[model samples]
Target: MPTPNPAALEFLLTRRSRPWRTLCLPAPDRDALHPLLTAAARTPDHGKLEPWRFIVLERPALDAMAQMVADRGGVTGVEPEKLSKSQAEYATSPLAVVVVAAPKPSEKIPQMEQHYSAGAVCLALLNAALAAGWGANWLSGWPSRDPEITAWLGLSETESIAGIIHIGTESAIPPDRPRPDLGKLTTWFTP
Candidate 1:
C-alpha cells in the first residue's frame, strides 16, 4: 500500500513564507541544497520541456549582483532609498536561488504553458525549503524586471525570472499575515 502523507499535506495547507529580511546566518550548503533543487525539479511539466533553470547565489555571486544593481542605479536614475533596498536584497542574502523561466521556441509548447511551469517551479522551491526547516521567501524587485538588469543576470530576451528566493535560518518569526477567504472565492456546482 502507498504510504499516506497527511503531514506533508497539512504543511502545504498552512505553510507561510517567512520574510527575506528576517533571515540570518547558516544557510544551506551544497550537500543540503541539492535535495531542495531536486524537489523543485519534480514540479509538474506539461511537455517535460523543463522550461526553467536555477542560479544559486552564494556569497561571491551575491556581491557581484549587488554591484550590478549599483551600476544600474547610476544609469536608470534610481533614488537612494530604493537603491539601498535593492542592495539589501543581495547583500543581506546568505543564500538565494534565481528561478528563470526560459521559454523554448516550439509551436507545440505554448509560451503560457511554459510560464506556468516556471511559476510552479518557484513555489516548489519555496515549499521545499520550508519543509526542510529553513526560512525562505520569494522576491523580485524592480531589478528583476528591468531589461538592463536581465542582461546583467545573463538572461536572454526570452527568459524571465519567476522569482529570487532568499533562504536561511530565521532571525525572527513575524506575525502570521491574513489570508483570503476560501469559501467566498469558491463556487460549488451540485447539479
Candidate 2:
C-alpha cells in the first residue's frame, strides 16, 4: 500500500501564491535557497532532458535588470504604464529566480513537451519556495517575451523565460482568489 501523506494533501489544497507586491525583504539566502532549487530540479522531464535552468537574481542584479527593462521598453515603444509595471516587478523584488526554458535537441521528444517541462519547473520552484515558508509568485511580463531582455539575461537563442519567480517574506497575506470549479472543468470518460 502506498503511504498517504495527509499533510502534503492539505498543503496542496490550501496553497496560495502571495502577491508579488506583498513580498518584502528577508528573502532566502543562498544556503537557504539551495535546497529549494534542488527540489525544483526534481520536476518531471519526459525525455530526461532538463529543459530548464534557474538564474538566481539578487538585489543588484534585479536593479540592473529593471533598468534594462526600462531601456528596452523605450526602444520597443512599449506603453509607459506597461513599462513601469515591468520595471517595478524587477526593481522591487528582494530575490527572483528566472526559470529559463532551454530546450535540448531531441529527435524523439517534441519541442512542445520540452516547453511544458520548463513550465513545470517554474511551478515546482514556486511551490518549493512556498513550502519552505517563503512567499513566492511566478511572473512573466513583456520583458520575459522580449528578445532584448533575453539577450540581457544571457540566454541563448532557443532559451526563453518560462517564469520569473519572485521570492520573499510576505508583508501581507492576500485574500484567496476564486478557484476553478473542478467539477465543471473535469470530464470523466467511460467506454
Candidate 3:
C-alpha cells in the first residue's frame, strides 16, 4: 500500500491564489526564491527536454516592462483601459517570474508536449511560492502575447510566455470563490 500524506492532500484541496493587486512588498529575495525555482524545475517533462526558463523580474525590471506595455499599447492602438490594466500588472508587482516556453527541436518529443511542460512549470512555480508562505498569483494578459513585448523580454521566435507569476506578502486573504462541481465535470468510462 502506498503511504498516504493527508496534510499534502489537504493543502492541495485548499490551496488558493491570492489576488495580484493585494500583494505587498517584502517579496522573496534571490536567496529565498532559489528554492522555489528549484522546486519549479522538478516539473514533469516528456523526453526530458526541459523546454522552459524563468525570468525574474524585480522592481526595476517591472518598471521598465510597464513602460514597454504603455509604448506598445500606444503604437498598436490598444484601448486605454486595456493598456492601463496590462501596465498595472507589471508596474505594481513587487516581484514576478516570467515562465517562458522555449520549445526545442526534437523528433522524439512533439512541440505540444514541450508547451505542456512549460505550462506545468508555471503551475509548479506558483504552487512552490504558495507552499513557501508567499502570496502568489498567475497572470497572462495581452502583453504576454504581444510580439513587441516578447522581443523586449528576450524570448526567441520559438518561445512565449506561459505565465507571469507575481509573488509577495499577502495583505489580506480573499474569500474562496465557488469551485467546479466535480460530478458534473467527470465522466466514468467502462469498457
lDDT of each: 0.91, 0.93, 0.95
Strongest candidate by TM-score: 3
The candidate, 1 or 2, that scores higher on TM-score is 2
Tens-place lDDT per residue, model 2, 1-191, is 99999998898999999999999899999999999999999999998999999899999999999999999999999999999998999899999999999999999989999999999999888999999999999999889999988988899998999999999999998898999999999999998
Give the clashing pairs for model 3.
none
Candidate 3, number of clashes:
0
Candidate 3's displacement at residue 103, Å, is 0.7
Q: Each prediction's TM-score against the native?
A: 0.93, 0.97, 0.98
lDDT of 1 by residue, 1-191 (tens): 99989999899888989987898889999999999999999999988899999989999999998988888987898999999899888988889999999988888989999999999999999999999999999998888988988887789989999999999998887888899999999999898
| Model 2: residue 49 alpha-carbon error in angstroms | 1.1
Off by over 4 Å in 3: none
Stretches of candidate 1 above 4 Å error? 1-4, 189-191
Sort the predicted structures by lDDT, highest score first: 3, 2, 1
